[model samples]
Target: MRGIVLNATLAAVKFAGGVFGNTYALIADGAESLIDILSSLLVWAGFRVAARPPDANHPFGHGKAEPLAALAVAVFIFAIAGWIAWSAIREILTPHQGPHWATLPLLAGVVAVKLWFSRRMTRASEEAGSTGLQVEALHHYSDAITSAAAFVGIGIAVWGGPGYETADDWAALLACAVILFNGVLMFNRALADVMDTAVSPEFESEVRTVALGVPGVAALDKCRVRKSGLSHLVDIQVRVDGELSVRAGHDIAHAVKDALLASAPHAISDVSVHIEPIK
Candidate 1:
């Protein structure tokens, strides 16, 4: 919600400031900020859907929505980058006065706000266990960087004599490259989520430790994991004495499920346990 409001305000500010002050960089950044509002809304909608309980159609819940939202954000970024590059190239070829001195403070404020937003996104990503939020954090950081570049471009044009008029255009071009690079990296991560990427070794080790802690279990045959929204779906196979009856093995499997769901820090939404008898 905060991000929505802030992005909208900054978008309007940068767009108006860009036109009034003749700074191509500020205009580009502002345009990107406007699309950021749409991205934020998409993320909000995705999370609302993801929070829904599992249904017949989506037995694993709607966790994939977050990744899809991230993909949309990446596409938006790519579009913004392309537009900025084109706009900047035109401004450079035609030539124009840089941003106004009056707009410097405003641009600085935008950078500060974006840096704060970047930090906030980082915390939110960690708490929610969301790769989407991680991508957003990076996006916000890029905004700060670009905004700073705009500020410098304007400052140099104002005081560094007449030939520096093209500085703002150059800054916009650089920002475009940075935005595209960030977008590509995020695209890959979101695609991985869509593919149901596996969990880390440390998490798998934790699952094994918990499962092996069971008294009747002789060994842990295997453990696997995959992301499901903010949680993971885990699979475990446990070995036990061959003499144990089928009923006993079944009980052990149930025990393993209960233990994992209760103890896992990553919030195991579903767990499948296979009992293997040791010969």
Candidate 2:
């Protein structure tokens, strides 16, 4: 919600400045911000859906929606990059008046705001362990980069007089490359989450330690942890004394599950335990 509002405000401001200031780069920036509003809304919806409890048709719940939302945001970034690049190229080919000096101050303010917001979002994403939030943070960072580039370009155009009007367009084009690079990296990360990538070894190690501490657990075999939205799902195999009764083995498995759910680094949504009796 905050992101959506901020983007809308920035978009409107940039659009006005771009038109009045005769800056195509500012207009391109405005277009990206406008699209950011839509992407932010999409992320909000994805989170709402992901928070839903398990239903009849979907046993694993709707956690996948989180990464799917991140993927969608990546797509939006790609689109805006292409659009900005094309617009910048067109503006370069056709000469125009240099951007107004006043526009530089506006862009400077935007860069500062975006940088602060990006930092804030980065911390939040890290704390929450949310891939979707991470991508959103990346979006803000890219915005800041582009705005800073525009600031420099506009500065050059303002100082260099008639000959440097096209510098602004070149800066926008450079920003497009950065945007595309970020898009690819984020897209790959989100896709990995969707594909059930394994969680970090350190996390799995913590899981093992906790499970081993449980009473009646002799040893552990295979232990696997995969990311699912804001949480993780674990599948583990345990080796027990052959002499233990079936009920005891079952109780141990339950204990392990409980320990993992309560003590794992990130929330463990589900656990699958297979018991092996060893003489």
By TM-score, the best candidate is 2
Best by lDDT: 2
lDDT of 1: 0.85
Model 1 lDDT, residue 241, Cα: 90
List the lowest-lDDT window of 10 residues for candidate 1: 94-103
How far out, in Å, is residue 102 in model 2? 0.3
Global lDDT of each candidate: 0.85, 0.90
Residue-level lDDT of model 2, residues 107-220, one tens digit each, is 989999998988998998898888888999999999989988898898899999989999999999999999999999889989999999877788889999998999888888
Model 2 has an lDDT value of 0.90
Indicate the TM-score of model 1. Answer: 0.96
Each model's number of backbone clashes? 0, 0
TM-score (C-alpha) between model 2 and the true structure: 0.98
Residue 61 of model 2, lDDT score: 84
How displaced is residue 115 in candidate 2, in Å? 1.1
User: Which tens-of-lDDT digit does each residue in 13-73 have in candidate 1?
Assistant: 9999988987878888888898888988887777778667799999888888888988998
